[model samples]
Target: MRALIIDDSRAIRMILGKTLRGIGFEVFEAGNGCEALERLQEIGRADLALVDWNMPEMNGYDFVCSVRSKAEHADMRVMMVTTEAEITQMIKALEAGANEYIIKPFSKEAVVEKIQILGLIP
Candidate 1:
């Protein structure tokens, strides 16, 4: 399987990439939403995307909206990975078409379990 991880922090990205790779996914990464979008355009499709809620340009909210706006990517699986702890923010992400979320400081097991529960990974 293939997945895309969008995050501004190199540390977070590396952690996520390593975790997903261990789960048998071929991972692609981007520093922010725009770069993620660019990668999407070039790569055609990603089986799943792990997106951070905050970033320098085009936060995950905007990225979700953008992805939903496009017919080609309308069904993309987008999961918010962030420090945003508000229930309202989680609702907003879902409203914007995110498939799931992983809160910040989450353990690798939690992340993996959520992805599995969301049916993104086997």
Candidate 2:
């Protein structure tokens, strides 16, 4: 499977990329939502997108909404990997079309579990 990790922080991207790749995914990355969109146009939609909430250009919420609005990307799995812990924010993300949520400062196991819950892995 292919996964895209979109975040403003390179370290966070690297960490998530490593974790996903370890779990048998081919990883791609973007600095923010806009870049992620551009990448989607370039390389096509990924099996999953690990998106961060606060980012430069377009934020994760808007990104999720945009992706969900497009028919081509509708089937793509989006998991919000963010620091936003409030229930309202979580609901907003879900409403915007996130398939799952994972708070930051997360363990690799946590990420893997979410992917499994998404049924991207068995």
What are the TM-scores, per candidate, against the unseen true structure?
A: 0.96, 0.98
Clashing pairs in 1: none
What is the per-residue lDDT of model 1 for residues 14-96, given as tens digits with 9 covering 90 to 100? 99999999999989999999999999998999888999989988898999999999999866678999999899999999998
Q: List runs of model 1 lying over 4 Å from the truth.
A: none
lDDT of 2 by residue, 1-122 (tens): 88999999999999999999898999999999999999999887799999999999999999999899899988899999999999999999998899999998899899999999999999
Determine which window of 10 residues in candidate 2 has minimal summed lDDT: 37-46
User: Residue 92: error of model 1 in Å?
Assistant: 0.5
Q: What are the lDDT figures for the candidates, one per model?
A: 0.91, 0.93
Report how far residue 64 has shifted in candidate 1, in Å. Answer: 0.4
In model 1, what is the error at residue 10, expressed in angstroms?
A: 0.3
* Candidate 2: residue 23 Cα off by (Å): 1.1
